[model samples]
Target: MRNEVIFHSEALEKEGNTLVQMGFRCDACGKTSYPVYELCPFCSSGEGSKTPLSNTGTLFSYSVTRVPVGPFKPPIIAGYIDLPEGTRVFGQIRADVKAVKTGMSLKVETGTIWTEKDGTEVIGYYYTPCGKEKGGAE
Candidate 1:
């Protein structure tokens, strides 16, 4: 059996929005990871404590997708972002595809991915544009 794909809860969405709204650090490292583990990617340390990450970062790369690859809607904005913590995560860009660039500053927002309990549809979380129009959570 395949592992169930988790989705963002309203609370997570709210938390993400709140974090961004308050400009909270949002980087997850081996040490700073909520679950905790060995190896710190930033400091290359096997031990480190959790710390807030800088929310400001430039877009490393992006793609304007016209096809519905999975549980996401068509014309999805997908790409990788380089965090100030020296971490890179693939996230969904919430800006208009036409208006996006390779080095644009982006504010990370919360998203959800979901799949039907018994159906074939899957969904989950992604990074989207967060601001006044996108519920800045302010």
Candidate 2:
């Protein structure tokens, strides 16, 4: 069976052993939105096209959830990545607790973040170090 994306209808693309997300660029405003948007939220423009988002970005901010929630375990690393396209997207930061910090570099990824009671997989975007040195935990 094919994977189901949690966000847009068509966003995830698999290459080799990795999964990447496709963003939408507004033709009217030049704004880009992750998981794709029907209309550009920045300028409220409806004209847009599919654009591949850079897998690389800077770690803007992050938080570790000590209390477990849903299909995610405790210490769930979540944060915002400031992409070069001027879009700041949020996703799970898959990295060692010690290596993650503000201003760090990150790369976008795609995977199943959770599974519903009916066994439906929640596939979504995630992040990790751009260098892939510290490695990702998700």
Tens-digit lDDT string for candidate 1 (49-88): 4344445556798888898886567788888876665556
Q: Please identify model 2 stretches exceeding 4 Å from their true place.
A: 1-10, 13-18, 115-121, 132-138
Scored by lDDT, model 1 comes in at 0.53
Per-residue error at 12 for model 1, in Å? 7.7
For every model shown, what is its TM-score relative to the native structure?
0.56, 0.77
Tens-place lDDT per residue, model 2, 55-134, is: 89998889999888877888899998999999888888888888888988897777677787777778777887876445
- Candidate 2 backbone collisions, by pair: none
**Residue 134 in model 2: lDDT:** 53
Candidate 2 deviation (Cα RMSD): 3.9
Predicted structure 2: lDDT: 0.80
